[model samples]
Target: MSFLDKAKDFIDKHDEQVDQALEKVGAEVDKRTGHKYTTHIDKGVDEAQKRTGEGDTRP
Candidate 1:
């Protein structure tokens, strides 16, 4: 299978973990950047979660 297909399958199986990891990474980036890029990081995280078919846990 192509890399994209394999990635999709992996993400489908680990969506929850992926979401958590994304959140952690986003938070780290926000902290390291002094929250200057928090808005952009959040937007990217949201887009990534959507693309990965991961459910949004944000209220």
Candidate 2:
């Protein structure tokens, strides 16, 4: 399988963990950027989680 396919398989098998990790990564990016891109980061994280089959955790 190609790298993208392997990554997709891994994400599907560990969706919950992937979701949590994405949240953490987004939060870190927001912090590092001094919250200047909080909205963008959150949207990106939500989209990533959705694509990984975790659904949208955002309210």
Model 1 worst lDDT run, 10 consecutive residues: 50-59
What TM-score quantifies how close candidate 2 is to the native fold? 0.81
Clashing pairs in 1: none
Displacement of residue 41 (Cα, Å) in model 1 is 0.9
TM-score of each predicted structure versus truth: 0.81, 0.81
Question: RMSD to the native, candidate 2?
Answer: 2.1
Clashes of each: 0, 0
lDDT of 2 by residue, 1-59 (tens): 99999988888888888888899999999999999999999889988889885565544
Superposed model 1: Cα runs more than 4 Å off: 57-59
